[model samples]
Target: VQDNLEGALTEADIEPLNMPEMDRDELVEGESFKFTLLCQVKPDIELKGLDALTVNRELVEVGDTEINAEIEGLREQNAELEPVEDRGSETGDIVTFDFVGTLDGEEEPFDGGSGTEHPLELGSGQFIEGFEDQLIGVKEGDERVVDVTFPEDYQAEHLAAKLAHFACTVKSVRCKALADVDDEFAVDLGHDDLSALRASVYDRLFEAATKEKDGDVREQLLKGLMEANEIEIPAALIEMAQKQLQNQMGMHLAMNGMPRDQIAQAMESETEGVLERAKEMAHRDLLLDAAAVEGDISVSDDELEERIGEIAVDMNQPKAKVRASLQENDRIHSVRGEMLHEKTLRWLEEQASSVSGDSTSASAEGNPTADDASDSNVEVADEES
Candidate 1:
């Protein structure tokens, strides 16, 4: 006979429970046993006041100042450095030099104390604050001794707030020539003219701002929904979420060029913070899933395929290749879950009331762009175990 105290539970489902030990010798071969299994189930999440939730959508306006800033950035990107023979070192000029630094009255130089043919930008503040200023009037071949004090919070503990002297030699100076913001620059960047480039930039910025605003509104709605709902999350789910977070963090570090040893070291210091964040994320995801079920929201195979196609296009890969890779990595479910979350958020947005603010500009901090929203939806899809 099968155990029915917990209502037709299998071994896999019954693992996370307090079950009493059973002696196999007490039963014969092919014989069954009956026992009680005490277990906890997923809590019921009642999402209320969703329709009454009010969120503010900040409308960000692209102005002339932002447009000009973009133009300036483009100009900087197109700038060229030309050697300057007539003038001494000055702000905005690149200076090349050699130097040996030592602490006061010390015969031995400090660690990382000497370098040759080092090219530095005068006003870039790459060196200590006073070190660059002392080189302002120095000519080529001029030998000078620069004095400066490291900041109290300097990275090197031994050098913190320490006075140091550098015996320096001026080598060469180069000034940057920025390309003019005109038709030629526009043509070089594949645009028709200056006006055309400006218009394109404005359109792109406006689109980004709009997407960012939508993301902010969605976040506010999610926060409101969570506040209106009360539920208890399972400990097993939290542990699973924490493990997923650790894996994601490791992957992120590896992708960003962090070595295995360094990643391990960094993770050691970040475990507590990561676990807390995992709990919060897990709680939010549980609430979202419950809300989706209540609203009869679901992801279809066609919808999942469409999203996969979009991903392939975005990544510039073949559709079949992308699908194969996702399948190999077992991330197809993640894509489906992300789509479902997106649909749920859209539904929530429609059901709730929103007010557009009168402000013409706003920062996009803590906001989600269309791309961010998509990532957020997929982030927890495969993590839920």
Candidate 2:
């Protein structure tokens, strides 16, 4: 009877508010048993003020200075390095040499203080201050003792702001030949001419800027929606979101080449910080979910299949395989939740008015902050699902 009741509730798409309470009567052999079951229904949510929200939309303009700087960056990327046998080291030259550094009153060189055949760009500021300056005018086979002081905030505690002497030897020198921004350079880059290259760069920059601005607008809309609505989020949901946040952070760290052990250590050390972010994320999620319900936004079966197909294409996996993987991992609901969230945001955006004269102009060469880029992808709380 208990099994039948549970199965029936699941089939009806009903979830108990808490574990069901059951009362049973003892029965003799071949006699019927009696039982009473009690369950609580989910609470209804009332969402308000979604249609009256206001959000600012930013209009971004890309300037010529930004385009010129982008072209210069391309030139730098394509610059050729040629051996410089006729001259000594100069600013902007790549110099190869060996060096050994020692502190005052030290008999042997310090740890990580020596190297051989190290290639460094003279004006790149890759070494300690004044170290590269002393390398200027040094020719092949020239040896000298260079003196420099480390900054007070150096990573190594013992060497911070300390004076040191480096025994350096010049091995070879090379200079870069930067390509001119002309028609010929455009041809090398697969463009018809300089004008074509410039147009392409402008288009890409404009697209990036527009995307960044859209993200800001979306965030503002979400913030407005959140401010207008107040809802109680379940503790269970918060815990799940926190775990999902940790997993995402761990994945990000691993993707950036952090070792597994180090990633574990980092997660351990950042527990409170991660939990705080998780709580905020979870709160936003609950608000979005309530709005979705109130607005009657939902993901259809066909929509889910379409989304899965797109993911398969992006991941270069077979659609059937990806579908099976999602089912096996019980993540189909997570995708559905993400789709619902997107729909809610779109609905809110339609309801809100974009404030005029709030547009800001910025350089194209400068990258957007992490907050600006955060909306490029929507991270669903898969664990919560």
Candidate 3:
């Protein structure tokens, strides 16, 4: 009957919801249902030959300045936090203290806090605004009471704008980091010496930087394609993206030990913004798929398997387990979409002419835009709401 035809819908070029024929039936009790109906047909894109497409592969050059920065970063990561026998704790030094935080006349400590060896770095601004600054002059074995008011929009409702007193007893003081950036340091890092270490580090840095620059070019190319191309995306896909985004975010928060109540609150606060982001991203994806078809670029089965293996390696999981997880979650289509996007980006690079000489490089140290100041507020809203 109509049910059998509906079951075969996926086998056809069109989806079950987009089938051309409409069928209906009425039961004995007079209850009736529309059995099958195809709303519309999907548009097709004409393909071009690979010989007609010309994509330029970019060459990224890294110099001494970039090498030095890379080496410094690696040294920092491998840097040891050693104790200073003579020097006193400074702005960046770690300060171990036993503290009792109290509100009003009550001497009770904050929940999960009190008489503990809490590590605080002066001027880190990790605690309340004035909390760490007040301990600037205090040395080891010193006892003091710090009085401060929490921000008006603090995360904890009870602590918001509340005047509080923290009775702090400094247990020990640790001083300046004496990092060894010498040939001996390189030997300790499993290298022969400083020169060999620098060379190796430089090579790795150039590879990483070149790859990153290429990724940026690819992103710009894909974004341009998405902007130029126009297509109506299925509403089902948008809804799915929204729900998937929510679920993924929930899983991320759960992995970070966030409670259910906190996750629910975060979702309620972020739903609208998340949906908007998802909608834009989904539209971009649909346009890219169309572009992939138009360019006749595709990923093979081997390419897909290679991609899956790479993702599994990045996640520190076995390939079999990752494959099983993807199958169980029915995310094979998501993987195909990812491959299609990559192919589409390659196609865009082929179509467009790019002039790449040299542009002024922005420092990675500072904030990217003025809008980041507003983003800080949004982040607070996300955390507290």
Give the candidate number with the greatest lDDT.
2
Model 1 TM: 0.73
- Stronger candidate by TM-score (1 vs 3): 3
Instruction: Locate the minimum summed-lDDT window of 10 residues in model 1.
Output: 376-385
- Please give the RMSD to the true structure for each candidate, in Å: 10.7, 10.7, 10.0
Question: Per-residue lDDT tens digits of candidate 3, residues 1-64?
Answer: 5566656565665653233566566645765545655465444533233223323445566555
Cα lDDT of model 1 overall? 0.76
Best by the TM-score measure: 3
Task: Quote model 2's TM-score.
Answer: 0.71
Taking all chains together, each candidate's TM-score versus the true structure is: 0.73, 0.71, 0.75
Candidate 1 lDDT tens digits, 176-221:
7877666677789998766667767767777788888888888898
**Residue 223 of candidate 3: its Cα lDDT?**
56
lDDT of 2 by residue, 152-231 (tens): 96655568889899999888887778776677887999987666677677678877877888788889987776678766
Q: Alpha carbon lDDT of residue 364, candidate 3?
A: 41
